[model samples]
Target: MKKYGLQLRAPSQQKKAAARPPLPPPRGFQEDEDDDVEREISRQASKNKALKDVEEQHKKALEEDPSVFDYDGVYDEMKEKVVRPRVQDREERKPKYIQNLMKKAEQRKWEQEIVYERKLVKERSKDDHLYADKDKFVTSAYKKKLAEQAKWMEEERLRQLREEKDDVSVAFSAISCDGFFPLREEERLRQLREEKQPSVEQPKGDHHKRGGDAVAAARERFLARKRAKLSLVL
Candidate 1:
């Protein structure tokens, strides 16, 4: 059984053993060292070529435009001729009706503003006139004159009031109380005293009672008078 097993080994193990080939011999140190040197040399050559290409480009640019070497001058020159966006002709682009309407609106606005300014000036002038005194001048003498005039006017008013009061008092004294005898000076003084005296305080209910009593008394007196007249007629 062992011999048969050996002969019938796995096909994968046989394939693996057959697939691998023998490796080549190790490289020499000198050859490896030569390869490193060649690689370094090639890298340096590439770097130098790149630098030379940049230098040549710079030289060509300077020859083409000497100002290219002067960066500030080149920048300034470009800036001076900067490309701006073209402005559209809105007047030409707009419809005729819209343009006419806009022009009319602008004219109307200007007219309205003018009218408003004129109105403001008129109003300000009116206000200044209203607040300012036409006859008064801005001086101490003028102020003193105005004060004296006001004082004279006030004194005249007081004198007129006193005269009117005296005339009223004289008229009151001449008034006859009973159609026969005019009020004497003493009687007038007494009446004035009575008028000045404080009235007696009465309760609200008493006021109504007093008023009713006075009305009844007056009615009785009127009846008496009517009876007396009737008797005289008979």
Candidate 2:
């Protein structure tokens, strides 16, 4: 069993190796995966380079000035940023004529208010008692008129009293001229007839039947009564 010249071989293993097919050429998906890996490696190399540069700059700054870092000293980016002004559209602006009309209207309204205030002040400045003297004069005139009326009434009353006194005196004089007893109205008429006809003689027969003598005596009596009334009036 020492056949060293030929290598020991399994006939099944050799047939399986020959029967296995070669792998297909690299696929589209595999190529895409390879490109992605290459891009990631390049991105990592760029990131490492940036970190190294920052470290070198930091080391150089430390060599120059060895002061402790102050985070508070750093300027805030938001504060340094400039605020943009608001932009206005041309359509938002009013026309010149319309703006001028509005301004004129406001000015007119202001002037009207000023004029109204001045008028109110002038009206307030007027005298409140302008007709005071005239009212006093009218009151005095009315009082004078009342006094004149009262004086005239008092004089009229006095005149009436004097007239009444004169009438009483006349009545007393008439009574005394005849006798102590006041004559009856018929007796007075008879006495007045006798006094007026003293020249006529007494009629012999009935006085009424003596027409001429009776007529003369009656006429004399009428004349005497008329004269008595006239004297009393005077």
Candidate 3:
């Protein structure tokens, strides 16, 4: 009876029963399991999309290749195409100042060579004719040299005259001061021609009638008279 009393009693005639926990739904465990399954499916779909995106990104990365951008090719190509070629063509290009310096140095060297040759010739000359009257020997040699020099000098003079027929120095320098008339023969001829030619003088104006050919006629007469006088003087 005490155990029975502990259980709640419902009045048979009452339409409403005491509020008991609602009866457990049918297939309650399966409904709970379905919720977990739907959540897992959504999670899996998201993971699959992420994986596909990653795979596509990986494929694109692999396909990307620059023909000669890698380290090994980069170094060799740079050396062959850019670095080594430039080095090979980098000649000993002296700037203008350095070139001028080198030219001066070469000129000095040539002068030194000339001086050395002169010294050698002098030493040889001295050794060959020791204790011999040096001036007499040198004079004889000088005379021989002068004859040889004169031969070439005459040839050069003729050559220059041929090249420069109108050279004032060659013609004028060869002449000595003299009567100088033959040189002025052409000028003399010109003067004679000018003297022989007739000249007319203009007489003072208003000597004749105001209108007529009288002025011209008088001028002709005066010229004729002057010419006759000059002829008488000559």
Best by TM-score: 3
Best by lDDT: 1
- What lDDT tens digits, residue by residue, belong to model 2 across residues 134-181? 533347876675575457546545755675565555555544543657
Q: TM-score for each prediction?
A: 0.23, 0.22, 0.23
Question: Against the unseen true structure, what C-alpha lDDT does each candidate score?
Answer: 0.62, 0.60, 0.59
Rank the models by TM-score, top first. 3, 1, 2
Give RMSD to native, each candidate.
Answer: 40.4, 51.3, 29.2
Best of the two (1, 3) by TM-score? 3
- Local distance difference test, candidate 1: 0.62
- What TM-score does candidate 2 reach? 0.22
Instruction: Superpose all Cα atoms of candidate 3 onto the true structure and report the RMSD in Å to 1 decimal.
Output: 29.2
lDDT of 3 by residue, 65-107 (tens): 5452377877787678876656655644436568889976854
